[model samples]
Target: MTKHIIETVTFRLKDGVKPADFAKSATAMNAYVSGCTGFIARRLSYNADGLWIEHIEWQDMDAAKAAAAGIGAPEGNRPFLSAIDGPTVTMTHTELEVSVN
Candidate 1:
């Protein structure tokens, strides 16, 4: 059976970066990823500790891996990358095993 893939990235904004700027970059990043093959959905959220989390859903592992290669391209990701504190970023990928909702 085909399994869904969840790609999560957690990071903090670079020093002196404004939330508005990050939002704009994120919106562009979302729009770009939405056009890739097997793209499902994506959401960006933050916690009180000032760390942001991006949750992206893909049709399967293959799709996620394929898209990962282009994540740092200048097309729509440069601004987003510029806003992030690179050293603080952490990413992981997982296959959906079960879902209640």
Candidate 2:
């Protein structure tokens, strides 16, 4: 199986908006992304600066794209545009090779 990684970098939250406030929205995103076709596993991490990291493993590239396209946009993402300190960045990659220990 091939693995796909999706890195999400979000700007800091604006005044009156806390990351905690968007916890519910985050969960919805998780569910939405996890339901993708090639989805095998997923991991999410965040930093104080609002940088979010996501690692997802898929069966193949087609599956990954299908899943991501289906994810669309969730309400939580609005905070990034309106109240976040900076713009959000996303990077996606498909594995060409991998190693296991």
Candidate 3:
């Protein structure tokens, strides 16, 4: 079987944007993400330092890359994107090394 691809995005919220506010946008963006081809699952978490991490699993790298490139276009993603401090964002994609249920 082919290994799945995992995409990790780390970012901070824009100044004055609260976590709750970001969540609402994330919830809305979920619909757009779920509709994308090869999307498998997504998880969002935050650290005490106010850093947010988003993990998305895709069927393959192509899907992950494609989704990342188009994520900003959907209306559902607008608020989510706008809530982020763009310069603080970092993203990476890696082959799934191992996973357990």
32-71: candidate 1 lDDT, tens digit per residue: 7998899988989998888999988999988998888878
Which digits, one per residue and each the tens of the lDDT, describe model 3 over residues 1-101? 88999999999998999999899899999998999999999999999999999999999998998888898888778999999999999998999989887
Of 2 and 3, which scores higher on TM-score? 3
Q: lDDT for model 2, on a 0 to 1 scale?
A: 0.58
TM agreement with the true structure for every prediction:
0.90, 0.61, 0.95
Kindly give the stretch of ten consecutive residues in candidate 1 with the minimal lDDT sum: 67-76
Off by over 4 Å in 3: none
Mind giving the per-residue lDDT tens digits that candidate 2 earns over 1-101? 33554433334455677667655555556656666666677665678666666667777777776765655465644543454444455556657365453
The superposed Cα distance between candidate 1 and the true structure at residue 16, in angstroms, equals 0.5
lDDT of each: 0.88, 0.58, 0.92
**Best candidate according to lDDT:** 3
* Positional deviation of residue 86's Cα in model 1 after best superposition, in angstroms: 0.8
Q: Give the Cα-based TM-score of candidate 2 against the true structure.
A: 0.61
Off by over 4 Å in 2: 1-16, 73-86, 96-101
Better of 1 and 2 by lDDT: 1
Report backbone clashes per prediction.
0, 0, 0
Query: RMSD, each candidate, Å?
Result: 1.4, 4.0, 0.9
Error of 1 at 93 (Å): 0.7
lDDT of 3 at 90: 98
